[model samples]
Target: MISSTAIAAPEIQHWQTKNGMDVYFVPAAELPMIDIRLTFAGGSAYDGDTPGLAKLTNAMMSQGADGMSADDISRSFEDVGAQFGQGSLRDMAFMSLRSLSAKEYLDPALDSFTKVLWKPDFPETDFKRLKKQTLIGLKAQLARPGSIATKAFYKAMYGDHPYAQPSSGTEESVTALSIPQLKKFYQKTFVAANGLIAMTGDIDKAKAKSLAERISSGLKKGEAAPKIPAVKRLEKSQRIVIPFPSKQAHVFIGSPGIERGHPDYFALYLANHPLGGAGLSSRLSKEVRDARGFVYSIYSYFSPMASAGPYIIGLQTRGSQVEEAVKVSIEEINKYLKSGPTDKELNESKKNITGGFPLRIASNSDIVQYLAVIGFYDMPLDYLDTFTSKIEAIDKPTLLDAYKRHVKPENFITVIVGGEQG
Candidate 1:
């Protein structure tokens, strides 16, 4: 068990701007740097008719804004010695900045960064180039067995749900994407009301507050996005095999897992740790890889999103050995399910997880990332402080029961890419 004094969560200060923008802050003056991340609603989940519109729109943000071209936008940050970043996912679109705390640099860095969120131009030239690049990426991804397997897995698991498509979208959908569509999606999603701000390192409350408000005010005022439609649970097990030219096969087995903050989340987390998430210490690695020599690597994880995300067990092996690898993997799952982790496994995992707690929040960027998740999901402020204790409290029966309820083979969606040629 972690002593209370062994770990302490940084003090988190949270408040909302008048316009409904959220701010989560932790002041860390030890470093001369500050990391700021801004997240908003409607990631790929809101792709609606177009599969990759949300991602494309996110990319277009840093290209140009307010008569500033991509080169100019990038150069501005470069000149100030600050780094700019942006990314999109199934649940949110975000922009991030890392800069020195000096007022001279922080002011202009924040200025340019703030402007890109609201004043994007989505220039025609960059749009064509970016779309062409996106299309090229799609072609490259389709050529790989691993990518094909993942794409098929999501499509099979979700089946026309908003989460069905990859964040990058398909080639056909991306080709047809237009600038007007991006503008509309941007206006609807990137509003002040939908935003959350997370800040860490080298700043006082006044500066954080002012920066949050300035960032919020730059965006158009609009309502928060509606809850994404629920994912439809699969009624039965299904397998999809797409034979590719590769000598190795990639296999993905999973079902819808828990959402963020599920009541039994910690139990499942510990359960998966020994089952597959603990690297060499995992059952999959020890039995399937070490003892049987069936797979190159095998691991499982629950990607808990705003909705129930995937609980995936992924592995790769020689095409001819695909059946054996999968059979062993499932056999291990059933055995583990029937009998939970041994007392030894549970205690070791707890130590392995709790031991690393300090390192997880050791840096400003790390905390900033956690802050983004906590703020976006409306999680408890003490979430970081309490994470290890929660893990410690979970026992074997609880972990096993949670796994049984959550991972049902009846609803498994398995996709295998590449196999022995028929």
Candidate 2:
């Protein structure tokens, strides 16, 4: 058992380079390995008429770079036993590396990153192979009920908003993407002005600054990233049912939740834990899984984003038991909406969150990612410091009011794939 006592947030060093690149360094001498990440505001949201540009560009960053062959790039990282990878979500793409802090290992890794980011040699042969693989992966996703349900759910919830589009992109859109489109999108979005460089490990402030500058030097200052258009509110209740031959129905029910800066965020976070946010201890799991044994798992969560993110409750159950599972999920939601959480539930929830907070930032790579998010979202420097206290302050009545305001069962946009509407 862990104590609910507050843990101090780690102090971070911040600096800006000559080319307007914001850099954040958190020096953790505990480990001999250094973690570095470069994040740009290039994501699926930037996928224009040509979809998957952001993703494909990110994936191919190291396939060939600075006239280096794909084999050479992979071998260089393996030589030092370092890890290099890239990932993208709806809002940003990140290229990250973990390597030994020894000067011998460090310089080569930095040079490799510089080459990968500044001058990718997207060979024609590899591009075709990568694109075809992506297309095949997309087709596989279309065949799965879980994939179909999530795709349909997003479209229904976000409507015409760019957020409605799948991150991996549609079959038609990705199949048509040209090399020029990817280059144009990369040049536009990967500018220094639209990104942050974060480094953590056994290093002093000066070396970290130099490494950040060196890696980002090739990037010229450019315009801010293109903004995602506003998401129109989902007005009517929507139900999308797609038939598949799977034995279990994948059900996703949700509505739009809070934005990154909403004041109600802390309250919502606390309220959700007991409702369905906590894994085994969550209400949805207990009611739908433990009590009646209707399904294997039932869970709910809210993703707070730059704009209103979706509040989602998802479950998978036997096709014959789908209606029963949905009914139990609704019952739990309605009960929470009317009564909120009890004082005991609220106390335990806060206890678990505050206790588990430190583990969340225990690693250098973890801290780098957290710092990147803080810089990207414009969240306060002391956001982590104030986290526990904020959760501690929410009383029962306050949470009850929040539940009444936010969780509306009637407004839920329910989507079920591979199940019949009974």
lDDT (10s digit) by residue, model 1, range 135-160? 99999997898889998998999888
Q: How many clashes does the backbone of model 1 have?
A: 0
> Which residue pairs in candidate 2 have backbone atoms (N, alpha carbon, C) closer than 3 angstroms, thus clashing?
none
In model 2, which range of ten residues has the least summed lDDT? 1-10
Q: Using Cα atoms with residue i matched to residue i, what is each candidate's TM-score against the true structure? A: 0.98, 0.96
Candidate 2 residue-wise lDDT, 119-235, digit = tens? 988888888888899999999998888889988998898877767889888788878887787777778887899999888899999888888888878998987786666666666
Cα deviation of 357 in candidate 1 (Å)? 1.7
lDDT of every predicted structure (CA atoms): 0.91, 0.84
Model 1 global lDDT (CA atoms, 0 to 1): 0.91
Best by lDDT: 1
- State in Å the error of residue 49, model 2: 2.4
